[model samples]
Target: MMRASVLLISCVLAVAGCSREPAAPEAPAAVQADPAAVAAELDALLAEWHESELKANPIFATALGDLRYNDQLPDMFSASYRAEQEARERDFLARVQGLDRNALSGQHRLSYDIFIADRESSLAGNRFPAWMLPVNQFGNYGSFMAQLGSGQGLQPFKEVRHYDDFLARIARFPVLNDSAIANMREGIAAGVVQPVPVVEKAIPQFGAHAVDDVEQSVFWGPIRNMPADFPEAERERLTAAYREAIANTLVPAYAKMRDFLRDEYLPKARTGVGQMHLPDGKAWYAHNVRVNTTTDLTPEEIHQFGLEEVARILAEMNAVREQVGFKGDLPAFFEHLGTDDQFYFKTEEEALQAYRDVQQKINPRLEQLFDIFPKADYEVRPVEAFRAASEAGASYQSPSPDGSRPGVFYLNTHNLRAQPNFLVETLSIHEASPGHHFQISIQQEVESLPAFRRFGGYTAYSEGWALYAESLGKEMGLFTDPYQWYGRLSDEQLRAMRLVVDTGLHYYGWDRQQAIDYMLANSSMAESDVIAEVERYIVIPGQALAYKVGQRVIRELRNEAEAELGEKFDVRAFHRQVLVDGALPMGVLQTKIREWIAAEKAKAGA
Candidate 1:
C-alpha cells in the first residue's frame, strides 16, 4: 500500500497556488543574457527542487512511477520536516529572485514567474497549523491508503519484488498512524481540530479497514489478484507473507487508528464548523481563499459575486422551466426535477451505461471545437463502494504520463436516484472529454515543460477549465434538450452556491445546517448529496471557491479575446493558448491570453 506520508505530501503539493495587476505589455523580443544559459540554470534549479521533494516524500515519487524511493516513507507531519520544507522553499525563492527576470522571455519568463509564486505561496502558507489538523472526511490518509492497497490504485504488485516493496511500506503504517494521532492531539490542545461531524464520519472510514480476518482485509487485494504467471511455490510464499502482513501489521495499524479516533479524538473534535474558530483562523482562511482561487477577492466579495451569479443563473433556470412548461415556480421546478422518477435511472448499470453512451456521442464531435486533443484515453468507472457515499457526484483522475494507466472518470453510483439523465451530458463533458482528462492529460504529455509545470496544478485553473468546458455543450450541439440545458444551469448553480456557502461557512460563521439549508433552497441536489458537499466545504475551506472563480476569469478572458479580435478569433487557437502551457495561476493565465490576443492582432495586421 502507498503510505499516507506520501499521500499527505501529494495533497500538500496538490493543494499548493498569486497576484492582482493589469498584465504588462509583452516584453520586446530582446535578450539581456544568453537565453540558453538562463534556461539551463532554471532547469538545474527545478531538478534540484524535484530531487529534494522525492527524498522528502517518496510515496509521491511512486505515484509518478519513479520507483527509486518505493521502499521509503517519511514522517511528513514532523515539525522538523515542515521546518526543512519551509527553509528549502525560502532558499529556492532567494535563488529565483537572484535570476534576471528581464533577461528571460517567453516560456522561460513564464516559468520564472510561476516558480517564484509557487515558492512564495508555499512559505506564506506555513503560518497555519495545517499539519495539526491533518485528517478529514474528504481527504483522510486512511481511505487513500486503502485504495492503494486494494490492488486498484497506484501501487503495483506485478512481481515478487513489488510485493516485498509493499510489505516494507505496509510495516511503516503504524508509525504514520501514531504520528497522525500525535498531530491530532496537538491540534486538540491548540484548538485547531476538524469539525465534530466531519471527524465523526471519518471514524467509520477508519473502521472499514480494521477487519478481523486477513483474507477479508482490503489489504489482501494484491494476494487475491496475484499474477497467474508466478511459479506456484513463489506464489504460495508471497501469499503467506501478505497474509501475515495483513493479520499482524495492517490490521493492527488500522485498529489503532480506528480506536484512537473513536475513543480519544472524537471527544475533543470541535463542534464548530468554520475555520474562524481556530487561532488566526480568519487569516488562515483568507490565505486559503487567495491560494485556492489564485485571486485577491475577499470573502465578502466572493459572497456577493456568488449572490449575483445565483440570481442570474436562477433567471436562466426560470427560462428553462418556462420552456419545459413545468407550470410552477423556480423552487417547485427544482423539487420536481430532483424527485421526478423520469429524470432518474432505475439501476446502477443503467447509470453507468448512460455515461458510456455519452462518451460515444461526444468523441466524434470533439474535433469540431478542439484542434489539440489529448493522446491519453480515459475510462469511466463507478466510484468504489467504500468511499462512494462521501465522494462527489463525479471526478476525474489524470492519466499516467507514460500511458501505462488510462485516466479515470469516477462517477458516484452510490445513489442511483441522484444520477439524473440530464446530468449525463454536462457531467461527461466536465469530467471527461475537453474537461479534466483533456486538460490534464495534454499537460502531462507535453514533454518540453519542466516536471513541476507538467505535474503541478492550480486548483482554480484546473477546476475553472473543467467548469468552463461545460459551457461548450451548447456549441458542441449537445444539451439540445431543455432539461439538459437546465442540468448545465444546475451544475453552474452548484458552483455559484459554493461561492456563497464556502465563504459563508468559513468567513461569515455559517453553521453546517445553514449551508445545507441554503443549498436546499437554491438547487435541485438531493439532501444527502447537499449534506455531503456542505460537510466537504466545511472540512476543506476555500477549495469550493475555485470552480466559479476560475470559470468566471476564463469566460471573461474569452469574451475579451472575442471582442478584441472579432474576425480574428479562432476557438481552436484560443483553446490551444489556454491549455498548451499546462496549469497556471489565474492572473498568469490572463496575462498569457492577453499576450496571445495581441500577437494574433499583430499577425492579422501583418
Candidate 2:
C-alpha cells in the first residue's frame, strides 16, 4: 500500500477550525467522478502498454504469455531498439497523465503511481545503455534460449506446433549472438564492459551448453520426453528438427560466444567490481541504487546504515552463540557450522527430501498464523544440475498467473555440505511458507489489483517480507530445536551481514575476497556459498541491501503498532493491511501503518 500523504498536527487544527466556520453558501458541486471511467482509462493504457512493449522486446513478451510475437526475436542490443523502448515509456507516461487519479479509488491510484514511477525510473536509466552489455555469463540470451528451447522451461510443450515454433526460435541464435557481440564491442568503446569476474565466470557456463554435438544438448529435453498423447509422426518430426537446430545453431553459437569472451572480451574487461569504476561509473551506480532499492538513499548513506546494522546484528548473534554453549567465540561457531559434516546432508537427494518434508510439516501450522493464504499449491524441487552451483541455497519461482503451475521452491544441492539441517526451518520459511509464498501468491490473487502491481514487484518489499518471515519461525513454533533456532539466528545474521558486505564492496572499496571473508567469519556459511554470494553482489550491486533494510523498517512499524495499540493489536489484521494493497515503498508502508493505527485508536475511542 502506498502511504497516505503525511498529516501534520497543524493541518488537523486548520481543518477543525475551518469546519467550525463553514457557514458560507455552498457553491455548485463539481461533476461526480465515475470509477468505471477511470478503470476504462486504465484498461486502455494497460493494453496500449502491452502492445508497445511486446513489439519492442518480443522474447520477454513470449515469456510473459503474449504469444503474438512468438516467432520474431527483437534485436535487443540494437541502438534503435533502445531508443524505441525509451520512446514507448515516455508515451505511456504521457497517456496516463490524462487520467484523473483523484477520481480513482486508493488501489487504482497506487497502481498509477507504481506504473508511472517504474517507467519514469526506466527513463532515468535510459541514460545508461545496459543493452550494450546484455549477454553476460550470469544470464545471457545464449543460455536462456537453450532453456526455452529445452521444452522444459517456460515455453509451452502441450502442442507439437509449440515445439516447432521453439525450434525456429532456437535457429535465430547466431543472429542474436552477432548482435550481442556488436553491442559488447560498443560497450568496449564506451568503457562500459562488465567486470572481469562476471565475464570470467560466464565463459564456462557458455561452454557447458556448447557441446560436441548439439543433437545431444540440454535442449533435447522436449525431444526425449514428448507428450505421450502426441502422434508418433509429429513427435519424430519435432525430434529431428530440434536435433538439427541444436547441433547446427545453438551448439555452434554457444561455442562462438564462449570463445569470443575468452579470447576477445575477457582481457578487455575491467577489473573493477562496481559501475562507479566504469567510465560513467558514478552515475550508473547511483541510478542502479535508486532503481533497486526504490528509494533515494545514496550508496554512501546505505553503506553507513549497513555498517550500523552489521554491528547490531553481531551483538544479537554473539548472545545466541553464548547461549548455545560454544566454547570458542562467534567466529569459531561460524567455522564449526561451515565445516562440520554433522550439520550437512549426506547426499543431494537427502537434502531435497528434507525440504519436501518441511513442505508437509509446515502447511497445517501456517493456518495458526495466516487467516489468508495463497490458494496456489507449491512443491519443492532441486535446482537443475546445470545451474545449481551458481544458484542461491534456495530460491522461489512464482506461479503462472493462470494457476496452471504452482509456485516452485528450488533448493540448490550443488554442494551438499552447504545444505545444513540446522538452517532448513529458516530456509523453508524464507523461501516458502509465510515468506515468499504468502506475499507473492496473495498479491497475484488480489482481483482488484491492476495487472502490473499483481505481477510486478520491488526487491526491497519482496525480499524484505521474506526475511521478516524468517523472524516469525519462532513465533509460529517451528524453531523448537536449539540448533534450528541457531540456524534461524545464523540466517538472520547472514542477511544483516549482507547489509554490511554488499555496501562494503560496492561503495566502500572492500575487495571481493574481503566481503567473502567477512561473511564466512560472521555466519555459518560454506566457502562455495560465500563465493557465489559475493559474486552475486559484484554483478548486482545494492540488491543485498534490501533484505535487511526493508525488514528493519517493517519490524519497527510492527513494534510501534504493538506499543501504541497495546492489548488491542491484531497481528493478522496488521499483516493483512501490509499485504492487501500489494507491495509499496518503505516510506509508503510506514504511512499506511500509521493510518491503520490511527483508525484503530479512533474506533476504540468510539
Candidate 3:
C-alpha cells in the first residue's frame, strides 16, 4: 500500500483553501475554434488542474518533484474546504467533458476517459462522511505529520529554504490536530467513530511524537545530522528554531492529540470491527469496495472468490509438502515453515543481505521479460525504527520524478524470525524490481502522459501488477529452491486471505479475533504479522480487497493475450502495453491490452 504521507497531506490541505495557484507566466490561451485546438486546451486544463492540486497539498507536490508550494499546509478536513474541493472537481469534470472527444484519438481519448472517471469518483465519494472518522490505526494524520516533521519523509530538509519550509509546515500541525480532534468528536456525535481497538493502536503512535525532551524526539533527526558545510551562524539559528518548534509547538500538538484520543475518542470508539456498525455503513462499505477494486463485485462475490482461491492455493501447498517429503499434513507444514531456524535469518544484517542477494539474482534477468525500464533507481532500507514494529513486512516508496531520491524498499526487521530467508526473493520482487518500483517509476518518467496519469493510480492496477510480478519467479529463474517456491505461494496466499478476511471483517460482521483466526488457519504467517494485518484491514476497509481482485484481472488478461496471439505474443511488448500509460482502471487496462493483441495479430498476418 502507498504510505499515508501523500494521502494525509491531501486530506489536510483540502480545508485550507480553494483558490488555484497563480497561472504559469506563459499559460496557454483558452481554446477557441479548431478541433486540434481542443487537444491543446485539454492539455492546458490538466496542467492547471495538477497545479491546483499541488497548491492545495504542498507535501504531495514535493513528493512529485514540484517544489512550488513546499512551505504550505492546507486545512483539508473542514466542511468548507471539502465543499470547495467538490466544487473544483465538478468544474474540472465540466471542462473535461466539454472537450471534443470525437476529435481525439489514441492517448488523447484514453486521457479523456481517465480524467472523467477520476473526477466522477471524487465527486461520488462526497456522499460518504469519511472526513468525520479520519484518524485510524493504519493512517492517521498524527502519524503522517510526525513522519513529515522528522525530515526523513517527503518533506525536504536539505538547503536552508528546505529547513525553513519544514519549520513552516510543522508550525501548522497544531491547527491540523485541532481539526482532527474536532472531526473525531463530530464522528462520535454522528456514530461514525473508528473501532476501539484501532483507535487504541493510534494512541501509542501519537505518544511516540509527544516526547518529554525535544532532543530525544524523532523530530530532532534533521538537527542531529545537520550538514557540516553550513555557516556556523545559520547552523546556530536553525538549531534554536528547531528546538523551539519541537519543544513548544510540535510536542504540545502531539500531546493534545494523544490526550484526546486516549480520553475523549477512545471512550466513544465503536467496538465493532465492521463498517456496517456505522450509520449507512453497509452502503459505505459497498462504495469502498467499488472504489478500491474499481469493480462492481460485491463483498459476497469477493468473499466467495477468496474461498475458491484459498482452497486452490492450499492444494498447491500440499503438493510442495509432498515434494519436500514432509511427513505431515498442510497445517504441520505451515508450522514447520514458521518455526524452522533454517528458514530464518539470525540477525538484521543477515536478512538485509539476503534481500540484497535476491536483487543481484533478479536484476540480470529482468530484461528478458520487460523492454521498458524505469530510469529512476531504487535501494533497500530497513523500516524506520519508530514505526517498524507495526509496519508490514515490506513496503515501497516510489522514487522522486527528478531522480534525486531513489525508490526505497523498506524491509521490516523488527522481528528477525518474521523476516524469513525463504520469503526474501518474493518480497524483493513485489516491493522492488518488478513490482512497485518498476510500475511507479515508469509512470513518473513517462513524459507523454498527463500529470494525473503519471502520479495518480488505481489501487487494483498497482497492487495487482505487484502480485502478478511475484508469479513470474519460475520464469525469471529465481524460485529454484523449494523453500523459495513455497515463499511465492505464501505471498500469494496472503493476498488471497485478504480477500476472505477483509470482507469477513467488514461485510460479514466478523470481529477482529475472527479475522485473525481465519488468517492463522489459512496461512503460515507469524502471529504478530497476522494481528498487524488484521488490524490494518479493520482500520482501512476495502483496501486489502484490491490486491487479489487486481492480480486476477491482470493475470487473466495476460493469459488471454498469450493464447490468442500464440507465437506472435511478445511478453516484453505485452508488459510495455500494460505499463506504458501508467496505472489504468482494470476495465481500461483490459481494453488497452485487447487493442494491443489485435494490432499484434494484424502485424503478424501482414
Candidate 4:
C-alpha cells in the first residue's frame, strides 16, 4: 500500500566539500529562535509544493495513490509546465538559500541540504527536454496512468466515490495520452526518439492498453476481486462504473495514443541511439549527468572508471571459469555460460517460484549478519507483464511509512531468459535480502529520522548499497555453488559495464552500436537483456555509475573500519551505522561513518 509517488533518482555527488571549520560559536539565540516558526514554514512550503506539483502532474498525484486531483491531467509535456516547474524550483531555492544554515542544528541541517540539493539538481536539469522523450516501454507516466485509470494497478475500489473518481480519472486520459503523443512527435523531429527496438517493444504495450472494450481490460481487477463484505447494490454500481470508465475513456484514449505512435510517431521517430542527435544534445546529457550523479564527474571519468572495472571483473570471471572447469577463453566461456539452456528457467512461473525460494533461503542467513530488521514483511512477485520488458531485471518497492503494506520485490520475468537460474541469487540479494528490501524498508520504518529522510533517497547511496550487498554472497554463505558465484560476478560485471556504456554513449561520443558491441563482447549477457540495459543507460544517464561507485565507497568504508578497529569491529554494527541515518549523499554518508569509526576507536581507548 505504498503511495503512488514519483521515484526521483538523480546525479552523483562529490565527497563533502570543505567548509571553514566552525568559526567561533556565536551567542545563543534568545529562546532558541522558536523552532516552531521554522517548522511551520517548512510544512507550509512542502504542502504547497506538493499541491502545485500534483496540479501540474495529476498523474503524479494519482501515483502517490492520492485521489484529490484525479479528474485532471496536467499539460506535463507542454512548455508551460516546464516553465512553471522552473519558477517553482527557483522560488524554493531562493527561499531556502536565505535560511540561516549556521543557526540551524542537528536534523535541521539535514533538511536544508536535502531540500536545497534536490531542488538545485532539478533546476540544473531543466535545460534538458526530458519531457520530449516521454513514452518509453518502461515506467514512464503515460502508460503508468493508463493502468491507474483502468482500475487495475494502484487505484483502489473501496467505496462508490472511489469508483467515481477512477472513472473521472480515466476520462482525463485522452488529454494525457495526446500530450505523450505530441511529445514523442517532437522528439522524433529532434532525433531524440528512443531506440528502434525499445520503441517496437512499446507498440504492444500501447496497443494492449488501447483495447476496444472496458470489460476486457486489466482495470477489471477490482470487479473480479471485489470485497465480499460490500453490499450487493454497491458492488453492481462499481462494476458498471469501472466498465463504463474503461470503455468510454480508457480504451479510446489508449487506441488514439497507440495509433498515433504506430502510425504517426514511430514512422518519423529517429533511429539515433543517444541524445547527442537531439537539439542541445550534448548540453542535455551534461545536465542529466550532473543531476543524476549529484557530482561534477564528467561522463569521461565515469566511462574510464567503467573500463577499468570491466577489466577487473573480467579477471574475477576468469577465476570463476577456472574454478568451474570451463575450457576456453574468457569471452567464449562467457557465451557458454549465458546461452546454456540449463542455466535458464524453463517457464516464467518457474522463474518467479525460484525467487520465492531464495527469499526462504536468504531470511535465515540474514539473521546471522544483522541485529536489526524491518518490521514490514516483503513479497517476491513478478513484474506486471505490461511494463516488464523495459523495466530493470528486478526492483523493490518500499512499503508505506505507516506499514499499511509490505515491501515488494518485483522479478521481471518478461524475458525468462534474462532471469537465469544463476542470476536468481544475485537478483534476490540485490532486490530483496540485504539490498533494496532491507535498506529501503528499514529507512522507512525508522522513527528517529525526519519524514523526508525516511522516505527520500538518492540513487547512488541506495543502489550502491544494493549492489554492494550482492558482493556479500560468500560472506553470507550462499555462493557455495560456483555457477552461482559466477552469477554474482555476472551481476557485478553488468553494473560495472553500466559505468562504461552509459558514459560512452553520453560523454565519449561512442555510438549506440559501440556500446552494445562492448557489452556483447565483454559480458555473459543475452542480446535482449543487453539491449534493454543499454537503452536504460541512454534514457537515464549517470544512474549506471552509481552502482559501482557507491558499492566501492561502502566496501572501502568497511575495509577502513575493519583495519582501524581490528577484531573489535562488528559487521552488524557497521551496517546499522550505514542504514540508520537513511539515504544521504555518498559524501555525507562517508563522513557519518567515519565519525562512527572514530567514536568506536575512542571508546576502545577508554
Q: Distance (Å) between predicted and true CA of 374, model 1?
A: 0.9
lDDT of 1 by residue, 1-606 (tens): 000010011112211212323245567984356767877898888888888887887877777778888877677777877888888889888997787665576777777777777776777788888999778887788888888788887777888888888888888878888888899999889888888898888888888877888888888889999999999998999899888888888888878888888898889888779999889989999888888888778999999999999999999999999998889898899889888999999988899899999999999998888899898899988887778878778887777788888888888899877778889999999999889889989998998898878878888888899999999998999999998998999999999999999999999999999999999998899998898899889887888998998899999999999999999899988999999999888777877788889899999999
Model 1 lDDT vs. the true structure?
0.83
lDDT of each: 0.83, 0.75, 0.83, 0.74
Task: List TM-scores for all candidates, in order.
Answer: 0.94, 0.91, 0.94, 0.90
lDDT of 3 at 542: 89
lDDT of 3: 0.83
lDDT by residue (1-606, candidate 4, tens digit) is 112111222332222424323346657873444566776566566556656666776655554556787666666677777788789889977987665555555556656666777786776666667787777776566567755644445565666676677667666667767777787777777666776655676777777776666556777766787778888988888888777777777778777877876777777766766767677888877766654454566777887888888899899999999988888989889778778899999998898888889889998898777888888778887777667767778777766555555678887788877777988888899988788889888987887665556666777778888998898888889989988988998999998888888877776767777988999998888888888888777766666777777788899999999999999999999999988878877666777788889999999999
Q: What is the lDDT of residue 481 in candidate 4?
A: 93
Lowest summed lDDT over 10 consecutive residues: which window, candidate 1? 1-10
Q: After the best TM-score superposition of candidate 2, give how far the Cα of residue 434 lies from its true spot, in angstroms.
A: 1.5
- For residue 101, model 4's alpha carbon misses the true position, in angstroms, by 0.9
Collision count for each candidate, in order: 0, 2, 5, 14
Stretches of model 3 off by over 4 angstroms after superposition: 3-33
lDDT of 2 at 31: 69
Q: Model 2, 2-41: lDDT tens per residue?
A: 1011111111121123212333444678665588898788
